[model samples]
Target: MRYEEELIDEVREKNDIVDVISSYVSLKKRGSNYVGLCPFHNEKTPSFSVSRDKQMYYCFGCGQGGNVYTFLMEYNRLSFVEALQELAKRAGVELPEREQTAEEKQQADARLTLRDMNKEAAVYFHYLLKSKRGTQALVYLKDRGLSDEMINQFGLGYADIYRDDLYQYLKAKGFSDYQMKESSLVNIDTVKGNYDKFFNRVIFPIMDINQRVIGFGGRVMGEGEPKYLNSRETILFDKGRNLYGLNYAKRSRSKSLILCEGYMDVISLHQAGFTNAVAPLGTAFTPNQAMLLKRYTNEVILSFDSDGAGVKAALRALPILRENGLRGRVLSMKPYKDPDELIKAEGQEGYQKRIEEAESGRMFELLVLYGQYNQQDPESRTEFIHEIAKKLAQIEEPLERQTYLASAANRFMIRKNDLENLVNRYGLGYQYEKVNEQYKTPPETEERRQEKKKSNKNQPQRLLLTWLVEHPEMYQYIRAYIGADDFIEPLYHSVAIMLFEQLDNEEKINPAAILSRFTDAEEQKEIAAIFNTHLKYGLSSEDEDKALSDVVRKVKLASIEDEMVHTSDIVRWQELLSLKNKMQKFSISRS
Candidate 1:
């Protein structure tokens, strides 16, 4: 069973849509609604709109629209129950105790069990690190300049060389073998039952944003085949979705995040007073990680190693940051290997100086281009100028693009006007202008408008859905005349079925309530677009009835035509024709 309807209603009543959305988005008053840049997608113009009266939000740019519950679910990546629990707390509504379903209970138990196992394992590893067995690992950490306080604070530990050391420890702690295997801390051995996953390694506990130890990273103390081994993906841990040291970095409250390469680099940076530092979990940066950073900071300073591989990784991350609507800067940690080495050699103050001297995304790209081509060679220089100009032309802001163009011209010993002419001649300027205009409207809204211009094919079906949602009382009247199968588009048919179902159960049939039926974000956005586009026209009660009848006729005619195409028999084809004629007659009579 879910939360009581009364409790859900109470929570919804207290949490106004506008108020809830304004916390994440800077909504500006526009008519009776609010408009802001969509948090779901990157865009310069404000296509995300909120309707206070309707308690719904729709982004014209990315097509993300839903109620406050949906906003929490999508924005925070929470489950429905999780979103509900959070909103109830914020709304000062107490959620009544309800017995969890078998599946819910099982999932909850699994998460708690895995987390407990990880915590216990971390404690055991820490204990071993302080014991005689970990003396070598402790000395190694000390030699690397990690103070005792840093070691204790980071919960650094050491795994024993014996495969069954942690397994026996956890077993003694009353954890079952199944639980151990599930935690990814132990590997199941066919003959031996279970063995520790990490052996003779330094342990680094990987915590979630909530500070719960969800997983672990183990680094081989000395020479080993695999230098570092991270926890496998589990229910509580997704390496692509979670960043190392974010739990601490978020507490730094810095305006910018220092993105590093590895776990040690992040820990070392934090030790050197750069607390707002995070790293991916033994993997290259991902789009999900980029979006996660955008939630915390507006800008990211890429402090990857200055080595060739690190440079390539930093270059690859630039576009991901841009696509996620986060500004990026490249930190050139030259004359050193990584942040850990740089901090050790130059100290925190020297590292701060390097951060300040970091290059902008465009300038960094130019620098990378310059490194690839020697300036003395005329052919390489020409190719470099053309490539740099193309990059500059892609810059959306005119001033920023012009500044970069000037910098490129000065660097290449060419006139600024000549570069500008070249960029314009390449048609990059026109393409940029087109993209800028496209961002002003939601992609779905534009496509719908273009579809309308192309033909009146799906217009009536879309109109029927909008009218039914806006006027739920008409559902019964419309149901008497037509069924969901009459609708041509699958999306429209789905919406029609949901609308009738909600009305049949005597429930509210607004966009928010209707959207809750769908789990897919894209499907919810599509339904929102259906309501958002047609509702703007403001059809009256009398107009709604007439429009509904006309649309039903059109939908029935479209459905019949579709059936006729498959009707090979002359009798079946004639039957479809007669059905279409009957629909036309009924529509004429209703009019």
Candidate 2:
């Protein structure tokens, strides 16, 4: 009925499901269908299957299944309309008359205008740096030993001294104060109204993993009170989660990720030919940031500043990395306090050598300082060992802890047996696998329940729902065989009912079709994830006789279970047999 829906229908009619899917996946023929490794999630074996007759695909491994349109949405992270438009272009289909709500139209227009503003601003600043006005900033960057390639790679720019310059430019280009604020390109002062936050500074754009300019970071041209300035928090910018230069780093390298303290360190490392590098925004290292790094490289080399504060920060971050299943190590830089200075002192090759020599340290080693091991009094030493042994027991690795014990024993001139006895006294066992399991869970407590509740808030349901919408042919089969009523979990049940009802009557199932029915965006997401998990199996051509018979038997059993306590339990059974005999004689006449 809608223009977008009509467009999607046309695209689906024009493009064969197999043709579109084959573009991204390596499909191998097996009997009547094709099989491949699931591209959505990391897995070694093939669970992804495509059926030409059904015009759908499924993954048994990840449970992601769908038609060509759904494949594009998940693989490329495109919206429904975007995916439709792309398929239409490939299929050569003309779109129908378009209509969008006034609010939707305005938001789309605002994003376009903001993008233009950002592009123009980035180019303008780059031009300013080449001009006489940008000489001071250019010299300052060079003084920091940044190469021209490095500067250009980061899209380094300069803002004029006047704060109103960017503000006026953006306003003239038809961006509202709110739009500029959303883009994180402008800041508002109570007295000054709107102004450029990066005025009179050299700018480095902070990009997402996809390399889009989500926000900016600026450093003063010369010595200023606040030496470095960065974009304020906005809708498009989240400093705690984003890393600089990861977009390029992920594409260029596959080995390891270099985690540095500052944005400049990340930029400088990329410039030095160590392409696999990333750095967090102003916030301290987070569990989320650690998990993100794990996607690209399980191994992480941290290059914190060589100061006391930096050492303490690294120590604090080690536990977070270990908890997230990343193999983390520390890069101790010599002859310089920071990564930027170290890279500048030694050429790129010198920095590479240090990264190679990086050493892995247990969290306890960093937390306890060497002085605790060498206390003058034996009692203090014993107490120190007990305190640290408890912490080491928290570590999930068996051999790693034993290795630490052996090393600690050698350093403290204590017998290995004594160290092992002390560790056992604290109930820190030597079994890495079993010990890791003990550390996995805290006792059932109110605080732990609250933490779980907080985490459940961020679960991705829309992704699951979208997957379901993509695979419509499986609707009847899933309902008949799997039974929507079997889903007892609240979140899964809500999605199952919605999906079952959506496909019950429709000739074709489009996930976007049901988006209008649910006002809650999170519900839409949950529906998507549900489909994603189910689509992995797709629809089977296998006979449903057994499944259907089982359902009937269950229904019969439920009736017996419900009537077990009748008013006249024995007489009720005789009455039921007489009623069945009478009903059978009437059925025989109809036959």
* Best candidate (score: lDDT): 1
Native RMSD of candidate 2 (Å): 11.2
Q: What is the lDDT of residue 159 in candidate 2?
A: 86
True lDDT of residue 585, candidate 1: 71
Residue-level lDDT tens digits of model 1 in 1-591: 677656765677688999987766667798888987687766556688998866789987667898888888777666667778898899888887887777768877898898888899889899999999999998988888887877887899999999899999989999887888888999987886678889999999998888999899999988996898999988788887789999999998679999998888888898999999999998878766886787788899999988899889988889778866688999988899998888888998999999999998878988898889988989988898888777776776788777888888897678888889887766566686755885463346776888657436777787777776666666766666677777768877878787777777888665666566676777777777777774535666566556667777888888898888877999989878877878887632223
Candidate 2: where are CA atoms >4 Å away? 1-107, 172-178, 188-191, 222-225, 344-349, 363-368, 371-379, 428-591
Worst 10 residues of 1 by lDDT: 582-591
TM-score of each: 0.75, 0.60
Superposed by TM-score, candidate 2 places the C-alpha of residue 439 at a distance from the truth, in angstroms, of: 15
In model 1, pairs of residues that clash are: 60-442, 61-442
What is the alpha-carbon lDDT for the whole of candidate 1? Answer: 0.81
Top-scoring candidate (TM-score) = 1
Tell me the whole-model lDDT of each prediction, alpha carbons only. 0.81, 0.65
